[model samples]
Target: MVLLKNYISLRDQAEIVRICHILGVGPGGLQRPGYSTGHKLQLHRTCFGRNWNQETKCQERYNRDGSIPPLVPPELVSLIVTSVQDARSHVNSHDELPLMSPDTALVNFYTATGRLGLHQDRDESPYSIRRGLPVVSFSIGDTSEFLFGHSRDEDKLKNVLLESGDILIFGGRSRLIFHGVRTIFPNSAPPSLLQKLKLKPGRLNLTFRQF
Candidate 1:
């Protein structure tokens, strides 16, 4: 696992917010995700490059609404790649994660009440899974209480505060660890960001990975 604090500049973060707003207005954009049991998630989601079917653990070009999802922006792709490479330098050579050609981005916008139950990101191909390709995640806006552990036992889970402009990457031996968002801290976003983007009270998370 690797954590880079304030890695994204304010200017770049603003640009990303703009892009998200633009894409979120179209079909197959920012909508509540639900489980197979019909329980709606507290957060809204939109996909780029490829849409993910959570229940099936499959990737599709079209979304549930039968509309094509937007392509992942070039800037985002560049950011993801660069972040991973930089993270690689901070770890020991033996634990360095494999560089992946990420072609899918899952964007989630979470409110103060948002939370995600513990889960493992294992939907990628067997080869990708075997290589321990990293998931490059960017956090913007409000802070989140992130939980991670080898097992589902809440007592054993560790917590981390993911703030705006933070980047979290986990792969290699830690790729299959269970993780999730416990909650979002209210009024924790940078004031300038909220004013500039006219954003609501929430955090925007983008996870880049190869499928």
Candidate 2:
């Protein structure tokens, strides 16, 4: 069984570095592409499901309906599964997390001028497992402000800077906790990666999901 501990990466950096190198952020040497949301709110998630986490783990997030963009190709789904498996090997079973398998990848791209509010990956239809599922998130390009909270949206919150190659996993008991990205660290990313990309900010995130 995996143990629940705080910032497991701080104590196990070698393992973290190995995994980050193995699981580089952004698509596997692919260019970023643009897609249309049809200019509409497809609202695949609901507030009820969002509330469940609030009452339980106080989390509010779920699987997105969008698929990986075509222009900006990313690693194959199977490859991510493999990478997730490889990364899990570094987890501290007795002090960090238990076994988990991330199947779906919700790739998020942000620009230096963009901002994402605080939210949690809780109500995702596929991860609605009452006990909650682990969300394996990888951050690449530019450091950003990552916020975390305990229960209510307004509580003892913590802010952490998530730079390129940072992997954050939240699930199990922590799955429903409220969390979000506040701001981008402007120009904290590589010029080559940002200037060459079609997307803004040059930051891309791939979150592995079981759904």
On TM-score, the candidate that comes out on top is 1
Task: Predict model 1's lDDT versus the native.
Answer: 0.88
Q: Whole-model Cα lDDT per candidate? A: 0.88, 0.48
Q: What's the TM-score of every candidate structure? A: 0.95, 0.55
Tell me the deviation in Å of residue 27 in model 1. Answer: 2.0
Q: Candidate 1, 2: how far from true, in Å?
A: 0.1
Which digits, one per residue and each the tens of the lDDT, describe model 2 over residues 38-63? 33211111211121112243233322
Worst 10 residues of 1 by lDDT: 54-63
Per-residue lDDT, model 1, residue 178, is 97
lDDT of 2: 0.48
